[model samples]
Target: MSSANLDPLSRNLLIGVLALAGTLASFAATTAPIQAAQRGAYEVTLPRTLDASGRGIVSGTMWCSEGARCAAPANGERAVSLCGEVASQFGEVSRFAGPQGELGSDDLARCNAAVVRR
Candidate 1:
């Protein structure tokens, strides 16, 4: 079939898919270093209080220690709670808005949920 004969919606969908793939690739490339750095050492502190939305606010002072021995908290409710807290904090930051922000929220939730299972 001739390219010009394709429906506009189909063409748009094709373009959108390509765009999404490109974006994903670009993000992976850019995030590789940051991910590597995060792998080195990290910590997240849980807050005692929850926001109006019932989400925990992580204290800025709380941080992961740098070292190979440091490990994330064991999975279960604790992990889900931690992820919820991180997601909440990220939500509060306006800069994190959009697809990237959504991904961040999902990541936090998954991490927390995984912890609960552990």
Candidate 2:
């Protein structure tokens, strides 16, 4: 009835089960943050009459223009994606308005600020 009385094979099997459970727990802990990071937050500035919820009816497709600076590894792409996700949730589709030519530091600052606000 105890580990001392169990056969060698039974003891090994119990150890293996315990090891597997520990491995699974550690794996979940490490991947939680990565999954959350991938789903970046986007703060959209809707008209004063509208909110993230589809309360105020905007009767047209939403437009989003990504600047050239967004292609960099910074918060550009993620913010745009977040905007798309939120827009879709509120029953409005989004289309990119081509590249933003001649982006400056102010552009990146505004983009990064939106993400932080989300």
Candidate 3:
């Protein structure tokens, strides 16, 4: 029932399992950000810098500067999907480059659709 009631071998085995689990958890925690830092790999460039007030957008991408550039870590989302996210946050995306390559004219057109026309 309690630790005091457990034999030495059993207790050692339990400790080993717990330690292993902790190590695994720690490993996952550290590896996630690294993986996130190197995924989807899409960069979105807008027509102009963000308004003087907005310096960056972090909600949808890894880092988006006010200078009309955004890089999305996008996890496993399709390039098209990430382009939409960047466009929605930073305005129409003029270019989107991902793992395979840059989006084609048609795909770029679709990616810009997320931008609200003012």
Pairs in clash, predicted candidate 1: 42-64, 43-64, 75-115, 75-116, 76-115, 76-116, 76-117, 77-116, 79-112, 80-112
Q: Which lDDT tens digits does candidate 3 get at residues 38-113?
A: 6646677888987754444445445646467766555566778777767776788788898678999899888888
True lDDT of residue 118, candidate 1:
45
- For candidate 2, the per-residue lDDT at 42 reads 31
What overall lDDT, based on C-alpha atoms, would model 3 receive against the true structure?
Answer: 0.75
Lowest summed lDDT across 10 adjacent residues in model 3 is found at 53-62
Give all TM-scores, in the order shown: 0.31, 0.37, 0.59
| TM-score winner, 1 or 3 | 3
Local accuracy of candidate 2 as per-residue lDDT tens digits, 59-84: 23233323211112124443444444
Tens-digit lDDT track for model 1 on 1-118?
6658889998888889999999999999999877655444223433232333332225332323222111232222343444445444433211111211223555555645543444
* Rank ordering of all candidates by lDDT, starting from the highest: 3, 2, 1
Q: Candidate 3, which segments miss by more than 4 Å at Cα?
A: 1-7, 52-63, 81-85, 113-118
